[model samples]
Each structure stands twice: as structure tokens, then as C-alpha cells.
Target: MSFADQADRTLEILALTPGWHRLRDLRPDCDDETVAAIVLEAANFAEGVLAPLNPVGDRLGARVVEGRVKTPQGFADAFRQYAEAGWLGMDVPEKFGGQAVPLTLHAACAPLFERGCVALMMAAGSTRAAAHLLAEVADQDTANEWVPKLATGEWAATICISEPEAGSDVGRLRTRAEQRDGEWVVTGQKIWISFGDHDMTSRIGHCLLARTNDQPGTRGISLFLVPNEIDGRSNGVSVDRIEEKMGLHGSPTCAMRFDGARGILLGKEGRGLPHLFTMIELMRLLTGCQGLGLASAAADVAEDYARERRQGGRPDQPPVPISSHPDVARQLHELRSTTEILRAAILELATTMDIARLEPQSGLDDFTGWMLPLIKNFGAETGFNVAGAAIQVLGGVGYTRDWPLEQYLRDARIMTIYEGTTGMQALDFLTRRLWRDEGRGLAIFLQKARDEIDAYATEHPGASEAALAALDEFERLSAGMISMRDDDPDGALYRADAYMRAAWSVVSVWMALRLSETNAVAGLAAQFAFHSARCA
Candidate 1:
């Protein structure tokens, strides 16, 4: 089946009505049919242009030739087509050459793009995040100049956060910027800068963080915008080398050097880390969307192959496809059901964000804030697991380079490690979301889950029991952690991964239960039952 068909059907099965209604309430001019048309167009472009280039990009990754980073074959052209098609500006504002569409609409189309080529999408993803941050926080004059170009894909942008010695520990970074003749001159070496030095665009804008004072940790850090070119001349920014990676090779992971580069200060001084977090949050959400797309793509490939590959049969009858086998069927069902649940959850999350933007004090803000880490960490792990299951369905052939399953597995592996690792996500969830607020966010989510379960129980008592039991387990697990606060202060944190899993299992099953009403026979009940049994 085509990606368009898959996306449409998934949206239908998941019943996007609540999210759509919320979005429409915010933007009255937005129409569902128009969004659907755009999604179909995106799917066609993904299959026709991006999908064909996936293997080509993987085979011939990005390279630095004579100080300039060059992307794989067809990358530049495909990106141009992607930009011209208005995808870059779809969710951006009309003031900046964007369509100003609701984010929920964009969320629906994300998987199709990632399904086509995840590597290629990374560059665009970073740029889109950069554009969003600029729009939100940059000085109006500076933003007006840069946002339009980024929105139209006429310029690309990158986030420079990691250094050789400082990956997750941004406070330890040694890069420095000094005020000289009314300009900030930056000098530093940054590693793991995705799309850091690509020739796909004439100019690249970098959102860099550097120290300006002697204050320790993140206090002295300030954000800077370093252009790839200045006044028709090369900026001090240069690509030292591109890292060879396990996957997503087409997107450059550059080691960059800044030697007295002219920097435009972004936001206020000494507040760089906080401002840059806007970009990080946006990137993490996009990364989650990427995971969803890849997992769905993996399932697509697996199901297609399984339905055709004959395995066993009676002597007089034709051999049945491997999909007829119980175990293989189970894997496919898990993959499909998990992907659909994640989709619904992500869209709901997006709707919350859309609402929060207009009404910051609204209770939805807390949910949006709390959902980011889970969406990113769980989404990434789900993609990885589903991709591996896809390989299992294909048996030996899936492990070989002859098929794309191996590539999918390799590409999906990095999602958990980058954009902040899963461990980091768990820490944030436990400490920031739960501990610091004293369970404010957790209480909200649990209350919402309870309400849903009560509504569901009225119709399907058996499924409702399973759902309530899962929620009960979550509460018990959380209570045990909370009880250890004084004597076993670090115990809850040490078991943060377990907590994350438990919470996700409950929330995901809740989402599945909601979706089951529309897709009652889609085996979601069985899926939730299995998960609830495990939670027990």
C-alpha cells in the first residue's frame, strides 16, 4: 500500500476528531480536506523522490571535499523539490512566507516524509526547528529578515550545541565569544553538528552557544547566530571533518571550527541555554515524529513481504504466506497497533501545544510540557523495536544489505541516543516533571486516564477492567517510588527507566483503548490486554 493510503487509513482508524476540533477552534479558516490534500501530495513526493534516494544517500553519505561538505547524490535536488512544494513553510506563519497551518496538520504528514528518507529529513527537521525558535524568540528585526528565508527553504539552519568534551554537559563547554567593534567574535570547535556544513544551500545560519563571562556552568553562556557567509565573503565557519556514522549517512555530522566568526547575539546575554532549549524541544518532538514514520515504514515493508512469501501448506493446497503463522502475525499486529497508538498520542500532544500557544495559562500547557520527553523517548524506542521486528518477519533476508530493513534498523538506532538519550529523558521525567513539581503533571495525566477508563468501562466492562488494572499498577508503582523519598532519596531516580516504561505502557494502552472504539476489531483490545497483563 502507498504511504498516502496508509496515513489516511491510520488517521481514520485513530479518529483525529478531537484533535481536529481543537485545532479548528483555534484557526477557523483551516479546513480538513485541504490538509488531507496536502498530506497526499507529501506522500507522493516522498515515494517518488525521497524514497528512491534513501539507498543512494546511505551508500554514498556526506563528505567534506576541500573544506566544503557535500551531500549524497540527489539530496540537493530532492530538498529543493521538497522546499518548493511548501512543506517547509506549511506550519510557519503567513507573515514569514508560511501557510500558517495548525501544527496538528503538520504532525499528520510527518511520518510520510520520514518514511521516504529519514536521513534527508534530518537536515530539514533541524532547519524547521531553527526557524521556529527564531520566530518565537529572536529580535523582531532579525527574525523578520531570517524567518522568511528559512520558512521558504531558501536558507538552511543548524544548531551547534555539542563540543568534543561537552556532549550532554553543556555547562562545561569552553567555546568563547567576545565583543569586538560592536560585533561578537566567536572562536570554538564544535562536534556532532548535523547539517553543519552542507553545500545544499548557499548560506547556513547556525544557532551557537558560547561563553561571554567567567560565570561557571550555563550562566555565562549566550546564544549567537553565525552566518555561513558574510557580505559575499566566507565567514570564519569551516568544516573540519564529517563523522562517519552507523546510519543516516546522507545527513552530515560535521566537526566545525569557528575562527573569529561574526556572531549576532540572540535573546538576552547569559541566557543562551534557556533560549536554545526552545530549539531543542522542537527538535526532540520532530525526532519523535521521525521515529513514528520509520516504524510505520518498517511495518509497511514487513507486512508487504510477509503477505507474499509462502511458508507452509497442505500437500494438495497452495502454500500459505508466513503472515498466516501465529507468531509472525503477532509481531505485525504489535507493530501496527503500537504505531497507531503513538500516532494518536502525538497528534493529541500537538493539539495541546497548539492550544497552549494561544492560552499559556491553560491547563493544557502542563500536559504539553510533560509529554515531550515521553513522546521522544518512547517514540524512538518503539521505532527501534518495530524495525527489529520487521527484520524478524523478513527472516534472514532482512539482516542483509540487499533489503532496506537493515538500513532502517541502523537509522532508527540513533534516535534513542541523540536529541538527548532515553536515560536523560527518564531523568527529566522523574526529577523535573514529577519530583520538582511534586507530581503536578503526573496527577493531571492520571486524572485524565481515569476519566477515559470510566467512560470506556460503561461500554466494554472486560476491556475496562484490563485498563483500570493497568492504571492501578501505575499508581502502585508510583506510590512505591514516592514512599522512598526520604531514606531512599535516589532510589526512585535509579529506577527511572522502569518508571518511564510503566507510565508509557499505561498511557499508550489508554490511547489504544480510545482508538479501539472506532477500530473495534483492529485487535487493539487484544493488544491492550497483552500490555495490561505485562503491567500486572
Candidate 2:
């Protein structure tokens, strides 16, 4: 099936009207027709441009020549088309060469591109995040200088955080920066930098974090906006080499060496982690959309395959489509239903992000913050599982390169690792978001979920009750975990992963319940209830 067919069905299943209405309220300039047009155009581009190149890109990947990385076949042309079409500026400000649409629309449109070619989408993803970062935190002059180019997709950007020794432990990073005359000179090495070096554009922006003083840990860290060029020459930044990775072959993941690279400091001094976190959080949100897109695409292909492939049925009967088999049906159901649930959750999160942007004092920031890890971690893990299940539905062929399922699984493996590992997300949920606030965030989240269930229950008792039961059980587990924080601190840490998963299951069911109000799938909530009960 084509991406347009698939995305249309997904938009319907998600029942995006209410969210659309909310978005319209937020951005009066973007009406339903305009939004629909944007989504359709994106879907068409994904299907027509990116999908055909996926296999070719995977086969060729990106290669380093001289000091630059060359992206796979058709990548540069496709990227240029994506830019000229103004997609890179979908949610950006008009002053920065953007269309200034609702972020919800961007979230809705992203999966189409991601599903078509995730590696290609990564460059756009980094650029969009960089544009947002500059608009939000950069000095006015810096923002004016770079935002227009990035927003217009004239260049690309990347987040540089990891090092050989420091992965999640950003506080231990050894990258250093010092003032030289009036400019800062950054000298260090960064590893696992996605889109770090690519030939798709003339300039690449780096949102870099490095040490500036003798202060220990993350305290002395600072953020800088470093470019790949200065005065028509290399800016002391070299692409040491690109990593031979398991997936995302088309996207260049580079190991970079910075020797006296000139940079403009972003935000405040000695507060780089916090400033860089703004971009990190944006990337995390986009990463969740990436997972959702991949899962949706995998489900589409697997369902199509199952409907066509003939397989065993009753003993005396002729073979029926594999989709008719009970186990195969279950896999399809799980894959589609879970993908829909994740979509709803992601959209819900996007809506809240819009709200947070429009009304900062509404306490939605806390909500968005607490929900980030859930969206990022759960969405990623679901993508991997759904892709694997798709493979199972395809049988042996799914394991081979003949099908995209294998590639989907490989691409998904890194989502849970990069943008913060699953373990790190759980730790942040427990240590930073949950334990730091001492359960207030969780309480707020539970109340919001209950409110949604109650609102949904007025019409559908069965699904609502199922969701409520899951919510109650989640509440019980949460209370127990909170008590364990003080009662058995070490034990609580040990159980963090289980608790996080259980909480996400409950959250997914709540989203499913809300979705049922519009989609009205008979057993959707029941399935979620059963799974969540097991987790509880």
C-alpha cells in the first residue's frame, strides 16, 4: 500500500479532528484544508521520493571521501526537494523562513517522511531541532544569522554530546573550550554524532557541549553553536570517520575532531546542559515520532503480506490467507493496535506541547517533561517489537533483505539507545522527574489520565471501565513504588524498569480508551487492559 493510503487511515484511526481543532485554535492561519494539504503533500513525497530510495540507500550507505561524508544515491536531490517545498520550516516562525504551522501538524506529518526513509529524515530532524533551539535560546544576532538558513534547509545541524568515555554521563565529557580573542575555540572529540558530517548541504550546525572551567562534573559545561565553515574555509572541524553501524546506513554517524573551531556561545555560561537540554528534549519528541512512523509502516506492510500469503488452515480445507490463521491474526491485531495506541499517545503529547508553548504558566511544562521519557522509551520499544512481529508474520522472507522488516528492526534498535537509553529514561523518570518531585508529577499524570477516562466513560462503559481498572492498578503500583523509594531505596532503583514499563502500559491503555471514543474498535481497550493487567 502507498504511504498516502496508510497515513490517511492512520489519521482516521487517530481521530485527529479534535486535535486539529485544538491546533486551529492555536494557529488560526492553518485551517483544516491547509493542514490536510500539507499532510497529503508530505505523504506523496514520502511515497514517491523517499520510499523508492530506501533500499538503494541501505545498500550503498554513506561513505567518507576526502574530509566529507557522501550520502547515498538520490539523497541530495530528495533533500533539496524537501527543502524547496518548505517542509523544513513547517512549524518554524515566519520570520525565519518558516510557515509557522501548529506543531501538532508537524508531528502528524513527520511519520510519513520517517516511514519512507528514516535516515534521510534524520538530517531534516536535526535541522528542525537546531532551528527551534536557535529560535528559543540563542542570542538574537546568532539566531538571525543561522535560523534562516536552517529553517529554509540551506544547511543541516546535529547535537554533539557523546564522547569515547562519556555517553550518558555528560558530566564526565573531556571536550574543552576557551576564549580566543573575541571568539570561543572548541577543541575536542565527539562520538556518535548523527548527521555530523554530510554532503547534502554546504554548512552543518553543531549544538556542542563542552567544559569551560575547572568546575567538576556538568557544572562548568557550556553550549556553543559551531559551524563547519568559517570565511569560506574549514572551521577546524574534521570528519575523523563515520561509524559502520547496524542500521540507519544512509545517515552519517560521525566521529568528529575539533581543533580550535570557532563558535558562538549559546544561552548562558556554565549552564550548557540545561540549554542543550532544550534541543535534546525536542530531539526526543521527534525520536518518538520516528518510532511511531516506523511501526506504522511495518504494520502496513505486514498486514498486506498476511492478507496475500496463503498458509495452513483447517486440515481438510484448502489453504487460506495467512491472516485467517488465529496466531497470525493475533500478531496483526497486536501490531496494528499497539501502533495506533502509540500514535494516539504521541499526538496527545504533541497537543500538550502546543499547550505548553502557548501557555507556559499552565503547568503543562511539568506534564510535558514527565511524559517525554514515556513517549521516547515506549514508542521506541514498541517500534522494535512491532517490526519483529511483522517479521514473524512474514515468516522466513522477513528475515532477509528482500523485505524491509529486517531493516526496520535494525533501524529501531538504536532509538532506545540514542537520545538516551531505555535505562537512562527509566532512571530520569525515577530519579529526576519522579523522585525529584516526590510523586507530584506522577499524581498529576494519573489525575489527567483518570479525567480522560471519566470523560470517555460517559458513552462507552466497557472500554472506559477496562481503562479505569488499569488506571487503578497503576495507581496502586505507583504508590507502592513511591513508598519503596524511602523504604527500600536500593530496591526501588532495582525495580525502576518494571515500574516504568507498567506505568507506560497503563498510560497506553488510557490513550487507547480515549481513542476508542472516536475509533470505537471493539476490543482495543480490552487488549490494552489485558496487557496492562499482566504488567501490574
lDDT of 2 by residue, 154-259 (tens): 8889999999999999999999999989879999999998889988888998999989998999999999989999778999999999999999999889999999
Model 1, 419-503: lDDT tens per residue? 8998999888877777776777777788777787678776767776777777877777777777767658788778888788777
Residue 180, model 1: Cα distance from true site in angstroms: 1.0
lDDT of 1 at 265: 91
Estimate the TM-score of every prediction: 0.96, 0.96
Q: Given candidate 2, what's the lDDT at residue 82?
A: 89
**Reference-based lDDT, each prediction:** 0.83, 0.85
Least well predicted 10-residue stretch by lDDT in candidate 1: 517-526
lDDT of 2 at 430: 82
